[model samples]
Structure formats: structure tokens, C-alpha cells
Target: MDQNLKIELGKQGVFVTTIQELYNWGRRSSVWPMQFGLACCAIEMIATTMARYDLARFGAEVFRPSPRQADLMIVSGTVTKKMAPQVVRLYNQMAEPRYVIAMGACAISGGPFKQGYNVLKGIDRYIPVDVHIPGCPPRPEALLQAFIALQKKIDCQPLTGAERPRFLDAGAQGEFPVPVPGGHDLEPTSNRGVWPVPITMNRGE
Candidate 1:
């Protein structure tokens, strides 16, 4: 091979790889979550994607029905023990680099149904959860925050085939620090009041 031709081909390869990475990043940023609403929390999940909260601003408002097409899964309601297998199957059907957001207290830790014989203790038992929104039904803003947190986690994650620092290994103690709860002394804010807030609609009468 001609030396110059070989060098040119190498440059082309590099360009293609860079372009592919950029495309992947764009797709990940604009994740379309599968809408798997099963209970009360579904209402709040819908509101988060609605005009007022505008999940579109974060590129997460696109809700897909098919698991294969969605980049993320939002478990927005109680997952019954009987429903656990189905949830796992749906999660498995999604393409690689998928994420799961356990929305609401129910999905996170079974909420008030923790004692229920039929309710799964938590959706986390069935799927690897990327974010947990804590509330009987978390406010739209809380869900949005969870999405933002998920995005941050995605950004920090190493790309495939990249050599991560040895200290960053999952088993490496101190390298991975668990976040501490700052304190619970502060009065709890009413998250319910944050939801269903009237949005100004100007419809000509």
C-alpha cells in the first residue's frame, strides 16, 4: 500500500469512529422511555412529560410503547409479584445501554404496599435500577430530577472498551463512595403541592 494512502485511510477510520460516538451520545441524551404505567404513580409520570413540567426540555418526553424501541424504562407504579417476570422480560428486550428509572415510592420499595402479599418489594428486585424517585407518587419535578441524575450517571460512565481506572472497579473500596443522607432534621416539604399546579393556558374563548 502507498504510505500516503495508508495514512489517509487511517484518518478516515478515526473520523468514522468519532462520528459514531457523537451519534450514540445524541441518541442516549434523547432517550425515549417505555411507558409501563401500572398504578397511581402513572398519573404523575404523565404530568412530568406534559407541557407544564415539559420533560421534552430534557429530551425525555418521547414515550414509546414497544420495549425494543425505548432507550429507558420507567417503572411508574406498583409491580405485583406476578408482574415481576414480565417487567424483567420487557427490560431484557431493550437494546444494550438501556436504563431503568424506578419511579415513585411504590416502584422503589413497594411504597405502602410493602406488606402486600402480591406486590413485589421493589422493582429493583427485577431490574437494575439507574434512578430512584422517592414519594408516594413523586412530583413531576422529582421525576425530572431523577432523569437529570440518570443523565449525569450516563455521562460519567466509561465508554465501551475504554480502560477504566483500576481504582474505579466495582469492588474497590473507598474508590466508590456511597452518598450519605445529609440529615433529616429539616421539615419535609409537601411534594404533592408541587404537582397539578395550574399552567396558564391561553385559549381564545
Candidate 2:
């Protein structure tokens, strides 16, 4: 729709919008994030919801305790190898159009714990991450920025055609596999469908 035309219509007390636009508008306006936190970053995540930051302005302040009722997952903190399965399981339980925001350095790349044998290098190995906020323990403002970014992402998603989000595509995988603990580490290491194992080419010595 043309901007000028929309304004003209508004002057006449008329409104115009398509089903796709309306649907996207509703989804972006009410993204309920799952109330799950992993480490220190969770503190900042909590602060983001407080009066100072007021995350409610973006319509994401209501954190759902159950995965089934949430559309967004803000992975805040370090994910340990032992807890990887539980995180993936919760993600699988979320309904279609689900999104994830990898918050803080730990959740994105394990931060200072990246070398720890128990810390999972990154949560992206098990599930798709829609946005990543880089910081040791990102302040509440950083989280709000990431939230807005996620909202913009949701708003731009097409309802149909090749550009449509995976959830809308009937053939796309509905659930991600939950990793299990093996003797040495999480079985399979990563979800190839989500984050493919990096291939390193070698030259003969």
C-alpha cells in the first residue's frame, strides 16, 4: 500500500490492510517469551521487564512459564552439556512461529566458559536462533534492542511464497531433535538441520 494513499484513507476515516499484514501485526505485537533462564544473564533479562526498562512497551513483558503458551525463547546464559537436552525439549514443545533470542556471550558462545568441558559451546547447536545479543551480561537496554529486532524480523516475515518462514511451510520440519547425553558428550554434538557441523578441509602433509 502507498504511504500517501494510506494517509488519505485515514483522513476519510477508513482503514486498509490485508490478511497477511494483519496476521503479522498481531504476532509481532504479542510475542510472549518463555520464562526460562540459565545463568547470570537471567538477571539482566529480569531487569528488562522491570519499570526502568519496561519491556511491556513492546508487548513482550508477559513471560509465559510454559513452553506451549510461548512464541519466543530468550536463551539467557550458559547452556551446559548436561542441560542441553532439556533446553531442546522445551524448544520442541513450542508451537509454530516460535522464535529464539540467544542473549549474552554465554548463551551465544559460552562466553568465558567456552573452554569448560561441561558448557555447551553454544545453544544454537541444538535449535535455530533468530537473534543474538552480544555481551558478557548484556544490560537491560541491550535486551530491549534485541527484542525490537526480533519484532522487526517477525513483522517482515512473508505469509506465503518462497520467502515465507519455515513454520508456515508444510514440508519444513516441525520439531527439532532433542540431544541425549553420551559417555563423553551430548550425542550427535549438534543438529545438522539447524547448525551443520563445520567442514574443515585438509591438505596432505
Best candidate per lDDT, number? 2
Expressed as tens digits, the lDDT of each residue in 5-91 for candidate 2 is 999999999998878889999999999999999999999999999999999999998999999899999999999998889999999
Q: Point out the worst 10-residue segment of candidate 1 by lDDT.
A: 185-194
Looking at model 1, residue 35 earns an lDDT score of 72
Q: What is the number of residue pairs that collide in model 2?
A: 0
The collision pairs in model 1 are none
- The 10 consecutive residues of candidate 2 with the worst lDDT sum are 196-205
In model 2, the clashing pairs are: none
The CA lDDT of each predicted structure is: 0.70, 0.91
Native-vs-model 2 lDDT? 0.91
RMSD of 1: 14.8
